[model samples]
Target: MHKSRTNFVFGEGDKNASLLLIGEAPGAQEDLEGRPFVGRSGKLLDKILKAIDRDRFNDTYICNILKCRPPENRNPSLSEIDECKPYLNHQIKLINPKLIVTLGLVAASTLLGKDSSLKDMRNNIFYYMNYPVLVTYHPAFLLRSPSFKRNAWEDFKRIRDYIKD
Candidate 1:
């Protein structure tokens, strides 16, 4: 399904970062640039991180659940997610971050292994491979639903509270 993808988008940031952020998949800008979260959503993410006094490149590592862009930028199917799981898992193992944050439903469900609503997942800490995991609205979702920015801010604050530096 991702055969036409231009880049693998294997992810980027400090390998030793204590924070690992996972999104659903690469979008158009991310695919073209071969970097995760480099589009409008990324810009918003930067602001979000800045609000909590975090930096994308220097502080937290960022990547997507699926490294490649799905066709038509559509949601990734189950088979595709299954195929990409190993790579993401390896990343998690290598990063060994103290905290893991899933930015959307796909990523959260992938880690938590449940189909709960983002609403249900928020403010709750789940575990992935012994690391604490948090779930929040994707930057894309926050952009579309500005009202939820408050909720996202709360989630980010939770992160800020944990990684006090």
Candidate 2:
């Protein structure tokens, strides 16, 4: 996969952050820059964090389930996810965040192993390897469906509350 890509976005942010955000996979801009959440979605994410009084740079460890981007920004295959999960798990272990937030259905499904709709998943707390997981709408989704912004904000407030605890 590395042969087909420009860079490996292993993720970035505070190593000791108490909050960790996991997305589905890297997008084109993220792949081009070898950085997580650096595109328009990322900018929206920044604003979302600010609304909750959190910062990705100083407070949260932001990463994706698959470090490498899929060809054409397609959804990841099961094999790809299987191959990449260990790396993500290793990162989670190292960060040991108090809460793990999954942005969008793919992420929530991948980690929580639930096929429930995003609406059903939102605001509900699940567990992955003993870490608490909260499901929410992705920033990109919020960009497309502006109505969901309120829901995402609510989820972030829940995230803030968890970190506070």
Question: Alpha carbon lDDT of residue 141, candidate 2?
Answer: 95
Q: Tell me the TM-score of model 2.
A: 0.97
Q: State residue 163's C-alpha deviation in candidate 1, in Å.
A: 1.7
**Model 2: per-residue lDDT, tens digit, 1-165?**
667788999998999999999998889999999999999999999898888887888878899999998988899998999999999999999999899999988899999888899999886889999999999999999999999887788888888888888
Estimate every model's Cα lDDT from 0 to 1: 0.91, 0.90
Worst 10 residues of 1 by lDDT: 50-59
Query: How high is each candidate's TM-score?
Result: 0.97, 0.97
As a TM-score, model 1 comes out at 0.97
Q: What does candidate 1's lDDT look like per residue over 8-126, in tens digits?
A: 89998889988999999999999999999999999999999888777887768999999999999888999999999999999999999989999999999988999889999888889
Best by lDDT: 1
